[model samples]
Target: MITAADYEQLFAHAPCGYLITDEKWLITAANATFLAWTGYTSDDVVGTFLARMMPMGDRLLHTTRSVPQMQLTGTVSEVSLEIVDASGKPRAALLTATRSVNHDGGVEHRVIIFSAHERRRYELELVSARRRAEESEARSVRAEAGLQHLALHDSLTSLPNRAGLALILERGLTGRAPGASIAVLFVDLDHFKSVNDSLGHNAGDELLTVVAQRLSSTLSSAGTVARLAGDEFVVVEHVGSATDATVLAERLLEMVNRPLEIEGLEVVCSASIGIALADDESSEPEKLLRWADIAMYRAKARGRNTWEVHDPSEVDPAVNRMRLLGELRHGIEGGQLRVHYQPRMTIATSVISGVEALVRWEHPTRGLLQPAEFIDLAEESGLIRELGAWVLDAAVQQGAQWSRLGDGNAPVSIAVNLSARQLADPQLACMVQASLTRYGFDPSLLTLEITETALMENPVMARKVLTTLKALGVGLAIDDFGTGYASLTYLKEFPIDELKIDRSFVSGLGTSDGDCAIVSSCIQLAHAVGIRAVAEGVETDYQRSTLLTMGCDLAQGFHYSRPLAPELLEDWITAQPPSVASGRAAGPGPAHAEPDDDVEMLAAV
Candidate 1:
């Protein structure tokens, strides 16, 4: 309904720029809006080519495609192009064009262009934000992966740790086919502490790292190797049999024993391995680890650089021993272990010379158990040190109590046995001194009985410990003397007060002439060295007579009395005849009417 002039005004002042081009694509007319948008006047734009307003790329695109497309369709909508203004400033724009025939029947194009600067800026910002988000997500993923790696791997060696080993073992067991076996090898380095002490911690770490690499490479096809803290590693594998595990362990040992160069020094190392096997899914990860640990200790006991497989048949005894080991801790704290006194008599006088404190475990379910039943287990389980310390304390306290009862005169001395482990402990002398101080007991009143084998194990350390103990005024006796490889030089070197002939030799007294001669020589040797001789296992008058004739100074056996509890010992001591109690030598005659009464009488003396 608008007039021609109003329509023309509307077209000239439109929000978008408008232009009319001829069939040759030259600009025939440009609206005021179009000229203003381009920073151009009608006189400058009219009769110019429309494509000249565009950048070279957009102009080529328009000439090649948009013109042909518009010719077929009569219109092109939303054609994006870049244009340069009259001032040579670039701008993004969207254009729409329509084709029309003028009165002379010539082709002309009407084009509308819109500025898109803010829209382009918004789109670029959106793309930048999306890219930043993707980068942040990637970083988070990498960080999470790093954290997981740190959690499961040893920082020093990059090997999986205990937790990772458990997980691997669990997964391996779970995924194993039925009747297929899963095995774990517990590896422990031997004498690793010596390396640490001799070199330094850094060298030790380097050695461990090299060992770990060797193990990993050796077992690459067979299993996974993991570190279980210092000098301990584990291997998880799916093996066929005990033999397979043993073979693998031997291979690993050979590889490990190969000389390693650490910090320019050639170091040789050895490892002991314990293997545990499971055939089915019912096997527990932790239990398998424990079995491997036990077997590893057994391997260590046999001598290091060896391997042992956990046998199912022997599991009960091993498990029971472990259980007893646990109970032993409770026993020590709960007073289940009692110290029984076995009296040692002066063979010349039949007087109570001293009492050997023997530990007996009054186990709740098993009843009374002797030292022979559990001592080896204790030594193997590392409980011997604790047991030895407890016995030391108890014996010292009892000796003190007896000294209190004796009014400081003729205090009954107590002898306690020490295990090889206890003797090897550097603090043995300190512990002994502490016990003596705690009970206010004279060190001379305490005798520590160590086996000859224990002394011979490391004579240098033994000499040092023995000398320290001797300096504290305590008596040291070598128990079971003839059984070990003790040379006369060793006997002369050690500050020994007594040599107790092993019961094995004394058991054959009077029956075996060779035994008789050995006992005689031991007695003479003891006297020659100015040390007292003690004959153990004297059960008959004939044995006692022979020992006394051989000049043995002390005798202890069932012939005198069995080991007795404290209260019974008190009663037995109170009932002895004064003649025997006053150090009068008893004749080696036939057995008395009441051997128990004789024992009681002997204890009283």
Candidate 2:
């Protein structure tokens, strides 16, 4: 194979170039593709060493002693080279080379190269396409993962939500093998609302994220931890003993209680833990969660920062909640609920301007009940939508009755308080319109009162509702103003007709100078905004005097009259002087009070 005749044929007319060298990396053999690729013919390339074709850095690698060693090792896969093309432009390629064998069974030490133009281009295109596909797949994966994460997580804290925890509990309870059990520990942060109220929701969210991380870190080896809305979290320990779960809960509480540096402020909150056993025999995930919830409430009741195991025999709060919801539903439908009107008096004249319609529940066996007893229960159970509708209708109907009963121009405006839930309700506008039409009462005579917190909960939505009500010619008042997180902000956003100073501030108006200043400022703020200021729960003559002196527009409390039935209200209004009735002769509306506090109280129902 090393014959001169063979060499001549290989160089002149052979399918490939051929050459031999003594243990040195001297050129060897090259095919026509290589010649065309490098713009060199046999005369210029045949005896030239491999170093001339290589870059300076690789030139040493193709020296005198390297060719034989490479031949001994056989072919190498995918080796890179930088060679100049016919145009002297740099080209990249992957190559494989093998040593040629001779008839004498000795290594001829010849080299052969297959030009990698098409193969290299194909490989590079494949690599590029693979990279693109990987990037696209990575983006798709990330987006889907983000959506899935959002679906199961709280938007505020990026922690798993109640739905996620339910799934985890289900899997933990059902996926376990025979004899395996799961312990679900429900955790609630103590006084978290105070933190939210005092530090704002942003700080509250930061605290929640920190608390979530701490809970996660605490259960790193124990089980999975998930947030279940608000200040509630759940820890599920699969195949764990009760004692292990209890220890995990204790550690979790400890971790949660650790001070958190949120926005450069140090804050701490204790956690209450409720533990429930979920053995393989359990049928429902809710049962386990219910047990844990019960235990958590028990922990909270026992002074918080503690853990408690679920007690099966005790009355379940879940059942009570369900019962209360049912009662609320029935109470609205069965006419077991009634609206009692409390007269609002003018601060100077003690004359009644309007009545605030308060709801009372007449439980079949529980006698008459204040709204505080069941209104929150209704809100918590999401029955406020229906209950609130009923109250609105009742108040409107009563106002209509008062309008029908009183002389013309004496339409008694009825002010009904609305919860945040009711104001944010999408149907609130329609409901008000429907109630107004149903009772054939003038919308202008129905005053809808909402707390300042209501506006902050969803300002844009609440504004829309208030605007709709205003367009309907109904009066909208911000109830419990100056006692919420964003009273000024609310007043700026919503078109309010009145500002009801919260009872907390009104209770100390005369005694506390700070209270007086606050009341004075509030009245000024309200009037400056073209809204009337009303004082609620003005129980003392001094409070009345102070509010009147401050130019408060309206005042209401037992100092005028407690919430009374329609009959008593009519009789009381008729007892006013005839000239006052003549002053009320605007026809079809209630009489306006010039502000007084000597109105007698009705006996407590």
Cα RMSD, each candidate: 12.2, 11.1
Weakest 10 consecutive residues of candidate 1 by summed lDDT: 596-605
- In the range 474-523, model 1's lDDT, one tens digit per residue, is 77889898988798999999999778899999999978999999999999
Best by lDDT: 1
- After best superposition, candidate 2 residue 242: deviation in angstroms? 9.5
Q: What lDDT would each prediction earn against the true structure?
A: 0.80, 0.72
Candidate 1 deviant stretches above 4 angstroms: 1-79, 82-134, 174-180, 220-222, 261-266, 281-284, 316-322, 329-335, 342-356, 365-367, 370-605
Model 2 scores a C-alpha lDDT of: 0.72
Candidate 1 contains a number of clashing pairs equal to 1
Over the stretch 1-605, how does candidate 2's per-residue lDDT look in tens digits? 49988866565554332335334446645556567767877677767766566665445455433444475575444456666555767666554555656677655455444346666566688999999999999999999999989888888767668887777766666667888878888899999998888789998988888888887776657478787778888887764588878887878878887887776878888989999887655547788888899999889889999999997778898788788778868878898987676767656556566666677888897789897788778777788877877777777776777667756323366666777887777788888889899989877667778888777777788788889878988777787778666656667778887777888889987568888888889888987777778888988888888888788877889887778777776666677676544433432121133322112111111
Candidate number of the best TM-score:
2
